[model samples]
Target: MTGQLTVTVGKSDGRVTVLTLSGELDRDETHLLEEAGEAALASGIQLLVLDLRSVTFCDSSGLRTFVHLHRLATARGACLRLAELHPPVSTVVEVVNLDRMLSLHPTVADALIL
Candidate 1:
């Protein structure tokens, strides 16, 4: 709520990186997401899962971060999938139709399988 953010990186069953995000995602916090994604890509992780179930808020900067990550991942022959976006974040994704542009799953398990 106060623009705070946290990112937890973990490995799923497959060779995928799962980033669990909590709290607000905005200009002040997007760096965390960017760093996690970039590090995963740099480390040769082709598949990424972003679990945003605990996210409380997100701004345009957060959206931009996601879009940029998607592009970077693609260029690196990687993929970024999002899962469990909170209501606020989900609304923004839906309004911008990013739900169509990005691979979105209802759960982390679902993203990991795909």
Candidate 2:
């Protein structure tokens, strides 16, 4: 379904930048997701915690976007972690075996602790 991805950035104990992603993250919404991460880095946000609980769907493009952003964070000596993925999104994450390459937390709170 058509939807929007809203990114809200916050500070986690003055150490990391928490980027909470809400709404569906599909092909149509993936570009915004990529820009959100890049913007965080550009704004000096090192550590990134992506809360995906509100994301109802994520296609290959969305996953690819995440991977690209993850690499960007790594290059900047930062980390990009995901948390609170809905069941559908989580299933795709598992199907793609992204769990093996990326850290997935149960919740945004948990991601912050990582």
Candidate 3:
């Protein structure tokens, strides 16, 4: 059985926006993340932070969504950062070396400051 994904707007100021995600991020749930990310980018925020401490699992589809969001943020002249990755999600990102390609932080506060 697939776990349900939940995306929540954790913070949204004029320049920075943070989206908190929980549950498994798989093929079936990528769209929820994509939509939330796109909306955050469209709002002209200079920085987009994804807080993934609650996300328990992630698949290739989640990686694709991250890349997609990165590109979108770049095209819109914004920055994307992922924060507080759980072990399962962090393992996937590290094994694939996506950690080198994406901005990652130990905490949402860290992402916000840097």
Candidate 4:
């Protein structure tokens, strides 16, 4: 519970920043997620893709972070997307119907293609 969340970010095509998050995005880890997301947006990256394939659990905090990131991306003339979400994270996104506002892909490669 005290450990830091692992958020790995990489650049692609000089325009896309892929942030791969592994581990739970709970209260203990939300800050890290937000920081990573903000950093990507701050870098002037036009496309932000979050790879949550390794995330086994997500709560309201995680969902809120995504929403906040979406706004950040929009303000920066960029895009924020979620990819490879496991059932738990996917459920939160679906219940909130964010799928309508944001893009969700089955894989990172798919998101990049978008």
Best by lDDT: 3
lDDT of 3 by residue, 1-114 (tens): 278999999999889999999999999998999999999999999999999999999999999999999999999999999999979899999999999999999999999984
Candidate 1 vs candidate 3, lDDT winner: 3
Please provide, for model 1 over 1-114, each residue's C-alpha lDDT reduced to its tens digit, 9 standing for 90 to 100. Answer: 357899998674346899999999998899999998898888877798899999999989999999999999999898999999869999999999999999999999999884
Q: Estimate each model's TM-score.
A: 0.93, 0.88, 0.97, 0.91
Index of the highest-TM-score prediction: 3
Q: Which prediction has more favorable lDDT, 2 or 4? A: 4
Model 1: worst 10 consecutive residues (lDDT sum): 8-17
Query: Residue 78 deviation, candidate 2, in Å?
Result: 0.3
Question: Candidate 4 regions off by >4 Å?
Answer: 1-4
Q: For candidate 3, give the lDDT of residue 61.
A: 94
Report clash pairs, candidate 2: none
In candidate 1, the residue pairs with backbone N, CA or C atoms under 3 Å apart (3 or more residues apart, or in different chains) clash, namely none
Would you list the rank order by lDDT, best first? 3, 1, 4, 2
Residue 28 of model 1 has an lDDT of 86
lDDT for predicted candidate 4 compared with the true structure: 0.86
Better of 2 and 3 by lDDT: 3
Tens-digit lDDT track for model 4 on 34-82? 9988987888888999999999788878888999999999998999988
Q: Candidate 1, which segments miss by more than 4 Å at Cα?
A: 12-14
Q: Please, what is the whole-model Cα lDDT of each candidate in the order they appear?
A: 0.89, 0.81, 0.95, 0.86
Name the candidate, 1 or 3, with the larger TM-score value.
Answer: 3
Query: Which regions of candidate 2 fall more than 4 Å away from where they truly are?
Result: 12-14
For model 3, the superposed segments whose C-alpha errors exceed 4 Å read none
